[model samples]
Target chain A: MRRILRKHAIVEDDWTLDDAARTPAGLIVPLARWRAERELLLASAAAIGVLLPNTEDVEAIYPQIADRPLIALQFPTFTDGRALTQAVLLRNRLGFAGELRALGDVVRDLVFWLGRCGFDAIVPRPDQDLEACRGALDELSVAYQPAADAHAAVWARRRMRASA
Target chain B: MYRYDEIDRELLKQRTAQFRDQTRRFLAGELSEEDFRQLRLRNGLYQQRHAPMLRISVPYGLLNSAQLRRMAHVVRKYDKGYGHFTTRQNIQLNWPQLAEVPDLLAELAEVQLHGIQACGNDTRNITCDYLAGVAGDELVDPRPYCELLRQFIALHPEFYWLPRKFKFGFTGATIDRAATRTNDAAVHVLRRDGAVGYRFFVGGGLGRLPLLGQEMNAFVPEADLLLYACAILRTFNRFGRRDNIHKARIKIVLREWGVERFRAAIEEEYAKIGASAEGGQLKLLPEDIGRMRGHFDAPPYRPAGEAAADLRAQAASDPRFAAWLKRNVRPHKSAGYRVVFVSLKAPEQAPGDCTAGQFEALAELCDAYSFGELRSTYDQNLVLADVAERDLYALWGRLDAVKLATPNIGLTTDIIACPGLDFCGLANAGTIGVTHDIYRRFDSLEAQYEVGPIRITMSGCMNGCGHHSVGHIGILGVDKHGEEWYQVTLGGSAGNDAAIGERVGRALSRSEIAGGVERLIRAYLELRSDEEETFIECYRRVGMEPFKARLYEAEGESGKPVPSESEERPPGESGQGARAGMARRGVAAA
Candidate 1:
């Protein structure tokens, strides 16, 4: 089992990755495979998850939000930021209630932002330090804009202080 | 001059601590050079030709005296006692060591200043008109909107790592003094339906590919500004090109997908974001805007009974002061005040380079003359935006003593040249050397005034950091067989009428560039309809044939047309601007 940082703690990941030829139970299949095998995957005994490519339209997965227990968004590279918007849309727009996992090119530098973008679980690359990745979540306590994270923006904080 | 509360101060403190640790890790060989480069670039540190240059953010071109003094102190202590003001209204220290940048940033934090998001692929500094509130032609003040946008863009989670660097410029006036059209996104304030809103323009940039911004929306309500911006940036972050580095800017995305398709995509994204529950939380409240506006309220002014009349009399008596008054001073919106420009383009010094002593002196002068406030213009000059009319003579005297009153604000001598081959490792040719030669050729103020109201922009590379594409006479330095040659572009403007200049003729060698410029100007002087016909105006009316005929004719060559660089070689053969933008921000060289 691969250990990942979830909610600021290191935990073992139970979800299995793409094995299109085998049964879809407990496997996070790619978006194309899941779309093609929607009926077959829906009839499975266990809950299924989908792995979304960064280039795919985030809204395409919205209709299937309730059926999946996890959505692993691809980062592709640390500098490729298409998945950040995808995660935000999934959490804020579609109101995805299940686990939001960040996969591929996940590193300590991007871990804080991943959490803010509503990614609950971060699958760090093979060489990344889990402890450091966990600590990166608390890098800054203040945010200038309201993100998927629960923290109030600085302007809201200012308003609260003024009201007090 | 928004004051920082505990939350703001704490945020800066935490950011400094994080960057300090990042620096330590890089030095310890824990982080790779590529990763460290990206990390340090977010904090405005660049590994330049000789040293690590630090670009300090001057948000919207506004700075208080204390902050200016802090900048002087930082430059004096860490750098070689000099800093360069860039065309984007930021100050860059060229000689700071990489190890000591954390200390420098901490010192700057004392004055509530940080270089955060000043130079990176993320949203850089949000810029506004230097004369935001005090300009004669005024609309709603844009500073508060800029502040709000700056806050929202700072350390944004979803848009931090875009395909390429992004820029935003705002202007309150109808004059378009901030060069808003040249930025990646432009927000102009206007009153629509009895309410102050913004007109948003997108996909404008000036690198190897220069394209003017197209209006995306005619009117975005004030409350929906942040939401609309997020929608646009989100669309760009998701779909902008990442395959080819040169084609990564938002402009290319707009080119590939036409404006109609781009607008449809943005509207779809905007609808999704606006319907999101969290999006409501991002809507800017009226009280929030009011609070930010209170920070920029005009300072109290004393009465000015006979100040203008007395200044006029003084100008009539002193010719030098009259020249300075005509060129360096502008009318202010306030009754008793005038907008004063402190020209950094003195004949003796490199354009935009100021010494430590000059910075300290400017801070003191700002305190004495302009209500303890000063601004940096995108034209590489400084402004005392609120000087009283009665104090014009005294201010001119003081500025003259410090070599700041050159009386050449928009003249040919007021050249904008980047820290080209001297400091920028990406530059192919030298800009400062050629600029000084051009300065010697046009040495007289009377001569420059005779040929009036012209802008000459030069860049050592095709990055267009010097904004050569929008200059009246643009000179771009190209490399030919390891020797420096310059290509001239004619008839460009950056104001409300923004247009990319057209390349005029063949490239000139290093020795021939200055004389070629002289011929271009001399042609204008000879062919102009009247003295009122500015260089751009004359060029627009008479077209390029007359100037081209004059430029190459004097070289003793036949009048046959020379093949363009594009016909011979690939367009923008180098594209050094992308690498420079990756290393530095938009304003790469200086």
Candidate 2:
């Protein structure tokens, strides 16, 4: 039987019965509402996951839920990629060792910045191509600065050499 | 000024590269004009009336001699010879080609400076009291905190695109010299229980609508500063109005939600963020703050007796020299050392005007005499922070030779006029011309100081960029009959007790402007209880009625005052003053 996650709907092969049961029941967290439910969601498995209301919402909440089992960042639109970038910062800066995911109407082009920020998995709409979307991550080998996902401090390395 | 770490330099370089690519793509028709407009604005390039102007962040108006020299080089190489120091403590270059802006940014990166977020709808350069670390009454040095905020907010993923521009100002001094009441969010460093923290105020702003910030947090512990600021930014991002660009600022959110509701929202958000420890750890530790304070070490000073003796001798010998010394020099906390304010408001020159060569010369002087540091004040004056008493004459001579010294620091001619219609498209009237008129009127430094200390500020319009609202004798340019008229206000101040100047009466014709100002000063001199009381104190004591009566006395017969006889008609308004007998003697009128 094939099941789908209602929020992002990225169909996974290794989902258990419990995962499937919880997938359909997702809550839409407005920016303010997310702040109120942050601690509660961090401790609860029943909540499934929360949606980012805006860019600032993700930035404010990212450090707190970096280690959570499942987290989804919502982008209101593709043009303003601030929230998606914030999700990456959570994974990168704060070392948010958790399942990083992207939801909402995220465009294919933005997948690069999102991946750079730290999103390992992206769940675009059912109409989008999953295979092509995955290829977006492999487009760029070198980024000028060390972003959320990248472990190497490229700027720091340059500075060390200049001083040496 | 703090030197940038490797991280700062790297970030600036990367940012320049990113902007270069963005600009290239835009030029190649890969991005729409609207998209490019936002992108360019984020990088501090603005499409102004004449050209693309770039506003470079000075970061609390603090610069060492080396940084200033570097900026001078940039200005000379990439832009016009001069730069405009803005009210928010940023420097604006009026003439930089749009195509060359990316290159300019690259050059600035080499100096560890960039125009990032200088004009964007994001957090702008954080301003603080120009005397932050040096002020005698400063409880804590606000530079480190300002620096921390600068780093955190720069390219912050969340706040890069807020509903409107956000401004934050910090002041460590007991006196509110940073104009905290006019910023979007202001942090006042205060001492609590022998520990340092901040008293946070939010929603304050000036412009079309002037509002004082309400105290959001009574006391924010040092550790939770960034977290709480983030919480506030998050709340504002979510709740601030996006429908109207004019009303979308955080100030509007505070107005709609009320301070109580707004504070509650931030507190609620703070609670959800959980233990402030994680965010607190990012803040400068107490020891780090102390270490930073050590960088701003005070220079050595001799005893005060020798300095006083030298000043007395100068006064006895030269009246002009004495008056200049009295009005322009300020006593430093250290004895035998003084803070010399280099007045930029010279006759016919733009306020804060300094050529590239002049900037270099000033930097050289600072390196030699002072401790290699130069501070740009809110009032558009530059400070040689550590001038020795013995070197005063030599320093003054060099400054005068360069035409950098005007001998009018806080007097009538030391006017804080905005770039008005000359460079800024937002202005309605020309402020630089009005400043010229005032400078010509108070040409004699002796006469100006004799009349006593006065602050004459002019703003082109009601936006108050020149801080006209707080000037002791504030002149605002008003447009009437397709000609520029001057509206004068009195008793405004911006010290511990700040009050907006009250309108004295009717606006003056451009020609009668200088005479009208002269009459107002004469009235102030006559009405003052004592010579010691400044114009503001006297105005406060007697009110505007006496000044108004004196100003409008000549027009008593016609019920409309004819322009003063000793007034020079505005450039084009000569026909209106045909009947005046004194019109022929335009020398006195000017």
Candidate 3:
């Protein structure tokens, strides 16, 4: 299969709906294009992905695509990770139960927080070390508090007693 | 004072630990500078022009004697021996080494204080009127609501990252002493049908735009206060501008959405939340309010009676004591008690500043006689609450010993001045020097009170740190010829009806400022309706033209204006001679 950067992931040029529809089985689409061709994309594709503009935008649109096959959240920049965190909320609270991937400028150190925030897969930039980045997520086994991941609430943690 | 229960204590302990870990990682080079910057700011550390400034939360500016003592200890041990009280009711210690900050924070946590959310693009320390519980004219004490908001917003997960900092202030009194108009959102407590509730205003802000808040809700029943606030935050999270940092505050959102639409959105979200109405969730019941009121009961005080009479007689006998009594003492709401103002404008020291030693002394005084309460006012003065009438003489004697007792509380030498260009990076000119010069010129307490109730506030720039816009006699330091020149404004008031002061034509030269002020006061003295009319009322009755013309008039042979000299009487006749003279000499050196 020919490899091409997903139109939504690249900002060099404007990508049409046809370009995104023909690209691959699993690829993220720009928020505007995703919303515009959501029904058409849903009818034609095996899985659909969307890049949210912000946490608020994700909240407003999460319910509409709760049962979608695969959802990918793109962090426009690593500086503000609020949207990526909100993607975790969409999966945990709204019960999306799908492949949750993180894309766009993500690095090795952020993998742990990304996992805690419910990202199963992270797409690093072309030049970065993907395997090492993935390994970074497993470096810490015990989390201090319950985030969007496996740990319980802080109150619950305090109440838990050790096994006899 | 609200005691921290187990949950509150654990939360603070854990938060401090988390910040410590974060600091460790940043020092170990694991976290990037940008990432650490955001994290550190969330914990109330800011990289200012000269050093790392840590803003300690005051929680609506309420502090007990013990808390203050701890703060003083922190200043002495970790920081330089002083802290600057900010407009938002927080305290900023300007010089703390980055390495020692965690220890400083750990110390703060022990006193139920922390720097969390104090200097970030998050909800900052919730401010309320400094005189909240004690003010006689208050409809209800707004501290409970302020406390509730403080707890609700502190470390809120969703709002941890915002486009810009959010500020909220509450006032129970009709007089908006808390500067509610200059906050992101303000709750004004209003009474309706014998029940107290809140009126919500949104998008009010001070920096750059300086727009007054617009009323978003006519009345929010006390029960729905937090829920409604959450809804508004959610709405702003969704719609507030993000692309532009300047336009990112809630104020801009309200402006863009318009008041009507924003209100409708908040109300719609509020209805969806479906009034949880759980116990302790909504407005406090009358009994609950009364219980809270019990927490703020007046501390034990004994009537001085004849002792106060004797003190008054002694004060009258001594001109210095008389001046001090007039300026420093205020009638207490309680019988035979008085609110003693501790002036921070001592000579050669920074105005509105106290050394750690002075703070400890004040704390000792607070513990001994003043009901253990200390208040930091917006005018940068300190109030020792619940002073016994009998202890007045003794307290004055002790305060005088420390040089903390300057008897010019609201007089001319008791000038409200900013750090100006000397300390603040955002200043255009130097306010401290100008204020000093003015203090030197009108040094007589008798002359100051003779001038009568002149609020001479100065700001280095238009940001108005000294609240120049509301000063009866306002001076804004403007830069001309690369030298500092001051623009004077007359007839502004921050009381029941707040008004921004108007400029009186040309800016005055640095040398001519004191003379200019003297001329203006001379004009007021000459054209008074009665001695009862304050500087504000007098300016209102007779417009700024007369004062303006007199001020800018060319000086003659005496090296100063003849008008100023003729109007100037010796100290006692001026009504504020002794205290004013002391304040002028003291503060001018500052």
Candidate 4:
């Protein structure tokens, strides 16, 4: 069984993704099917999400699925960081506040950076341990450059505490 | 010398643990070789030709006596008893076992020294004018900004896998002592309208394609420096070529896209990045500057006192000390202080290679005479930045005794050469042997003193580690039919007018380098109009033709690069050269 890490803990994955023949709901579709059968998926009552490839033209896809329940960003390889850019845009530029899940090649090493880049859920590759991923988040107590995370940089934090 | 706070200390400790774990995983056969290589590179560990070479960063070339002693102990205990100082103002141990690097890194963390961001595709140790704080002509000390950049970029997640490694340097002084323009991005700190800002220059590089950095912004407010730098790197990371390693550096991207387009992209990225919520976090707070300046404040100095008069009398009375004084000593910003340069190019050892014994003595001297701090100059010599004028005589005696006082600072014999074939895996030719040969030719202090200031730089290959491209007389080692051939370039300068040296003619053989250098120096001495005219001044006044003519056509006969038969096999049926085709890593044709 696949486990999803949400809010720094293992959580049950609710959303079902079926690519072959779309069942009677709860199916996240690829870009082609989502565009081709857009009216059917949109009108359906079951909650659905879209899986975005690392190379997705996020700007073009943004207008189409502005109100999707969730977005699953795929990392083709851990080293390929295009999805991180897409995630940053999704969170800040497009105001994506709903579920943002990272899947495929989500190794333990990339978990901390992925969290900083606005991913709320991670589905790590088979080789990566879920508990190890949790530990990666607490590795560094300080970050000089602020990521998309809510916390201010350590420098700012240090200044605030000093004044307080 | 930004001292680490509790937060900063935690970050380093965490990073060391992470690297240690990764190294452990790799050694246990869990991680792949290629994966381990990329991971190890960011920590400055390289599987070199002979053994693993670890480059330890000396941030802006600043080190205290205790840190120096620690390095001395580490190197002596680990692999070799010495380390090679690099052009980037870092130190490289030529031999270390791969398995021991993790333990070594843990040890280095104790002294606040590690290989973090010293190599690989990240911002190189932010370099600056070695005389930054102490220089008389400095507008503002660039160290605070350098340290700021250093902290901001170390283990920065976004820049972990840039298309190529990026180098950043800055200088507040009017003269470009740090070779600021050769870096991928540089800041020339200036105070305009009573506000300190920086002039950002981009795309200037030396290597396979060398071009002077173009000024991107005349003045960027100090608050936005880090944000702007981040935007530049992000832009490069997105658009730079990852397919071809040869054309991977930001310079190539900037060149191919043209400066106007590249500038537009960067500005767009900058504005986007600025608009983001995270942007404000990286901005420099006023307290940050105040905090850093406290650490770098000048040590307590005594009044120049009777020492100035005593030194003057000593200079007049003693010719040897006078030569040493005239060459090695320079004025320090503080009263009663003088900067003394200790040349690493001693009699026998390679240029910039200092042994453990040397560091031990130097550390003791620094603690006694100076303020227990030693700064490494970009020219590969060490500096006693805050040496008192009173102790100048005593320090010189000690230095001369150790063979460190060569009296060749900024003179003809003070040569800088990279460890070409002798140590570096990327080198196609030898550098130390040539520097030693040339140094001995101009051995006499009287002869070298009379010849005057001439900058000679040599690189084993196009990877201009020796910074050969900017030398007043640059020598690049090219492999000709598996044999070493030295190519000479006459008019390079790393000063305000930074220009890459142009080749004089065809390349010369290994044996011909020292003789060729002597002839060029002789030509300069003869052609110079006055005694005040330096070699560069004379070369600039009279173009490369005169010097080229003298070296090539002694009696008006075209003679260099005589068509010779090659004993080494020319090429295979594939038409590839005898030597393997290797990508030039910067030596960004400065």
Judged by TM-score, which candidate is best? 1
Candidate 1 local lDDT, A3-65, one digit each (tens):
998898798877778765655347888888887888987787657888988997877757865
| Model 4 lDDT tens row, A54-93 | 6676766898878987888887767666677778778866
- Write one digit per residue (lDDT tens) for candidate 1, span B1-590: 77787877888899999999899989999888988888899999987766887888998998899988888898889998999999899998889988899999999998988888877788888878998889878788999999899888989999989988999999989899888989999999889878989999999988789898889988988888898899889888988899988899999999999999998888887776678776688787898888999999988776766445477799899999999999999999877789999999999688899988888889989999899999998889999999989888998998999899999999999998888766766676668878898999898988999999999999877788888899989998776544566889998888887889999878876777888899899999999999999999999999999999877766644343444565332223444433433243233443
lDDT of 3 by residue, B287-310 (tens): 444544455665655655632445
Q: What TM-score quantifies how close candidate 2 is to the native fold?
A: 0.78
Q: Give lDDT: candidate 1, residue B367.
A: 92
Worst 10 residues of 2 chain B by lDDT: B581-590
TM-score of each: 0.95, 0.78, 0.79, 0.91
Off by over 4 Å in 2: A1-164, B271-283, B299-309, B478-490, B502-519, B548-590
Given candidate 4, what's the lDDT at residue B532? 86
Kindly list the per-residue Cα lDDT of model 4 for residues B265-366, writing each as its tens digit. 888877876787657666778897777777788777877674354688998988889988989999998877899999988876788988888888889999
Segments in model 1 whose C-alpha atoms lie over 4 Å from true places: A20-25, A39-46, B306-309, B556-590
Model 1 per-residue lDDT at B398: 89
Q: How well does candidate 4 score on lDDT at residue B358? A: 84
Give the Cα lDDT of each candidate.
0.85, 0.70, 0.69, 0.80
Better of 3 and 4 by TM-score: 4
Scored against the true structure, residue B360 in model 3 reaches a CA lDDT of: 86
Judged by lDDT against the true structure, how good is candidate 2? 0.70
Residue A8, model 3: lDDT of 19
